[model samples]
Target: MKLLVVLVSFLAACKAQNPEPCTSPALLSGQLTLATQNEQLWAFARYLYDALGQRIRLQEMGFYQNKSFTYDALLLYREGVMYEINNQESTCKKRALRADFHPMAVPRNASLMGQAVLGSSSGPGQGVLVNTWTGHLPDNARYLVTVTEFGCIPISTSYRTQPFGWMVTSFFNNVIGISDPNQLNPPGFCQDALHEEPIDFFSLFHMMK
Candidate 1:
C-alpha cells in the first residue's frame, strides 16, 4: 500500500539524518559523574587509557566523607597495579592488583567511619557501594558505609566488547533516604533497586560503535 511505502521511506530518511559516530577510538579519556541533590553521595571520576589498555590512571573525588581517591594503575590480562589513597592522611602505596574481589568492596573496620563490617556485591561498575551491617560497629565511626561509587574500564582495541573499551560500572550508587545507615538495605544488585528512593546511577563514557 502507499501508506506502507511512505512509512518505509520516512524510516529510511530518519536513519540517514543521524548516524552513530566512531566510538571505538585508539584511546579514551573522559569524566564520570555520580551525584544526587541531597549530596548524600557525589563523586567525579576521570580516566585515561589506550587501545591496548596496558596503562591507565584514574582520579576520583567524594568516596568517603567528601574524601578523594586516586588510582595510578594499569589494566591488562586481568592484572595491573593497584594504587589508592583513601584520604589526605593516607599516603599512596603501590601494590599488586587484586581483581579477585569487586573493587568497591571496602575493607572491614575501615577507620574512615563506622567501626562496622561490609558485605559484598556482584554489581556492575566501581561506582558507590554501600552494603553495611549495622549492629556491630567497632569503635567510633560515622556512616555505616552501605553506599559507594566505583568504575572499571577495560580498554583495548582487541577487546571483544565495544568502543575499544568498556565501563563495566561507572559512578553506580544505591542510597536510600532513611533515618539511619542501617535503615538502608538495598537489593542484591544495584540495578535491581533502580526504581527505589535515592536512585542508583551509572554513566556511559563513550558511545559504542
Candidate 2:
C-alpha cells in the first residue's frame, strides 16, 4: 500500500510540474487556423496580418513621433499592396487591401499582437487597433494591449507537406481603446518585451478582432 501511494504521488507531482499548454497571450502570436465555417474570423486574421506587414515601417515612425512615418491615408482593404509595393502614387493617409481569404498555412516562429482588433463590418472602417510596441514601438511608452481567453494546440495528425506545430488562437480586441500607458499602473508579462529596444519589427504582426 505504501509503494502504491508513493507511485501515485510521483505521478501527480510530474503532472503538476508539466502544466497544460498556454491558453491566453501565448496563443496570440504564431501560426493560426480556423474552420471554413469560421470565415469571418479567417478574413479578419488575414487582413490584420497584411496590414501589419504593409504598415510596419509607418508604425516605427510613430515611435519617434514621426508622422511622416505615417504612410498615406490609403485604406487597407483595397489598395494597400499596390501602395506598399510601389510608393509613388499613394495619396491618402491610410491604405486598405483585400484580406487573404484562402486556407493559410503559416510556419513556426510567427505570432500576432494581442491588442490588434477587427473593426465592425457594419460600421465604417474606424477603430482597428495595432500594437506597434511588440517589436517596433517602444518600452518607456505604455503601448501594450490585452488579449483574453487565447489558446493553442498542436495537431497530432495532418497530411500537409510543410512542417507545422501549434495552432494558437486568442480573443483580442483593438488596442485603440485601451487606457494610456500612464494609466495601466503596473506593467504585465506582455509589457516586459516593451523596454527591450532595438527590436526586430519584422517578427511582429497584427491579430484579427
Candidate 3:
C-alpha cells in the first residue's frame, strides 16, 4: 500500500512539472523568412474571399497609423518553416469578414538561410499559434496572411456559445494556450468572438484585408 501511494505521488509530481508539451507550428521557411522578418505587422494584411477557385483572389490592407500593434507570422515548428511580410498601407476600411479579415495567399516553395534572429531583436512574436491547419494553402503564389493572437479575459463557455465567434474563441482558449478566467455564461446568441472581454484574433488571420 505504501509503495502504491509513492508511485501515485511520483506520477502526480511529473504531471505537474510538465503541464503540456507546447509546440508552435512552422509558418514559413528559408529565404521566405527574410522577406517577412523585420517587417511591420500591418504591412502584409490581406483578405481571401473565395479559396475554392483555381486562382485565389487576395485583397490587402494596411494598419491605422495611430494605433500600434504586434506583428505576426505563420510558423510550423515540426516542419521547420516560416514566412516573412513587411509592407504597410494607410487606410481604415471594412469588407465582409470573408473578404476583409480572412484572405488567402499562396505559399512559397523555395528555401533560404538566415542567422536566427533572437526573440527580442526580431522574428515572430508571442502571437505564435500551434496545432492548427491553415486551411488550404495556394500552390502558385505566396498568400498574404495575418496571424492574430487572442486572449480569453474572463468568460465561461456554459453561458456563451456564439456561432462562429465562440468556436474561434474556444479554439484560442483551449487549444492555442490562451486561458480564460471567467465561465462563459448568460448563454445567448452572440455574433462577436469577444462578446465579453478582449480576445485578440489578429494572430490567426495572416491575411488581413
lDDT of 1 by residue, 1-209 (tens): 99999999999999774322112233446655544433334456665544443344455554433444443322332343343332344344434443331232333543333222234335554333322222222332222223222222221110012222222224323221212322112112322212212111121111000
Q: What tens-digit string does per-residue lDDT give for candidate 2 at 156-192?
A: 1112111122222332332322233222121122222
Q: In order, what lDDT does every prediction score?
A: 0.34, 0.26, 0.25
If ranked by TM-score, best first, what sequence of candidates would result? 1, 2, 3
User: Candidate 2: where are CA atoms >4 Å away?
Assistant: 26-58, 62-94, 100-177, 180-209
**RMSD to true structure for each model, in Å:** 21.8, 19.8, 17.7
After superposition, the stretches of candidate 3 with alpha carbons farther than 4 Å from their true spots are: 1-110, 119-139, 143-176, 181-209
> Per-residue error at 125 for model 2, in Å?
43
Error at 86, model 2, angstroms: 19
Better of 1 and 3 by lDDT: 1
Report model 2's TM-score to 2 decimal places. 0.23
Tell me each candidate's TM-score. 0.30, 0.23, 0.20
Model 3 over residues 1-209: C-alpha lDDT tens digits? 99999999999998774322121231211111111222332333221112122111222334423243333332222222222222242212212221122212212332211112223534566234211112222323222222222221111111112221211111122232213211111112222213122122333333332
